[model samples]
Target chain A: MKVKPLADRVLIEPNPAEEKTAGGLFIPDTAKEKPLAGKVIAVGPGTSDVKMEVKVGDQVLYGKYAGTEITIDGKDLLIMKQGDILAII
Target chain B: MKVKPLADRVLIEPNPAEEKTAGGLFIPDTAKEKPLAGKVIAVGPGTSDVKMEVKVGDQVLYGKYAGTEITIDGKDLLIMKQGDILAII
Candidate 1:
């Protein structure tokens, strides 16, 4: 199934299993600074004011509790606003 | 003290005590549909694509955990994006 986000929303595939990478990927187990890492699966056209900065396949960092979780095609995914994304890694 | 929000951000004065009012005001006791009500104290200039729709003194509703809690002049306030606001009440 193809998912399309609307108006600044983004569809992300979380990389929770990337804990072993040290190239500034997701650091899930830390007590402080627990930003989640994910790959952008899809991006919305963005609002008139906020231009879309992220593109699909972009590796990004987001807040710990930034998005809503959903299961698509038996895979877990996250849907959030582009604002929830902190940076592209 | 004057607060000027920037880029679609709104400074809101939370009316938690409005639970006592009966005119479709904040019902702080409800578990479902618990949108917090507040008054806009400051408005941002807005980004290029998004226009500022909320003005200072506009009564609005927002999410449960929308903005960062702040204290100014001994008063508690919230600073959030205008998008966090659900509606103008």
Candidate 2:
């Protein structure tokens, strides 16, 4: 199943948190911070007042705890309003 | 010190979390959810590529973990990009 956002909202697929730094020390899951970057999967048409700024396939950075989590076709995804996004990376 | 956001960014002053609910029960700080609503204190001159949507004085909702926290002149504030805002409430 596919997810679609509504009115200034977006659907994103989160990137996994890095388990190792450039120095190559492994980090465990408990020590891992929530990921803040993702790939845009879908975008809303935006309300009459707000215009959509992101498009599908855009790599975005979002708030660490943003969005409602959902499971679609056994895949974890996030549905959030555009405002939860910080920047296109 | 006064804060001025840059390039599609915004400055927000968060509303305090509600300590009492409509039923008059008190909520402890440990149980309180992070405030997601705020009053826009300032706005950035958006980059040429992106137009600004929010203005100063607008009430907005943002992601709970959005923005960088900073203190200016003893006041706590959040500096974030326009995309971190979820809606104008």
Tens-place lDDT digits, model 2, residues B26-72 = 45658545337888998866765678998889998887677765444
List clashing residue pairs in candidate 1. A48-B49, A49-B49, A49-B50
For each model, chain A TM-score?
Answer: 0.83, 0.78
TM agreement with the true structure for every prediction: 0.46, 0.48
Candidate 2 per-residue lDDT, tens place, A16-57, comes to 655212113334423323226679999999887556777899
Native A-B contact fraction in model 2? 0.00
Best by DockQ: 2
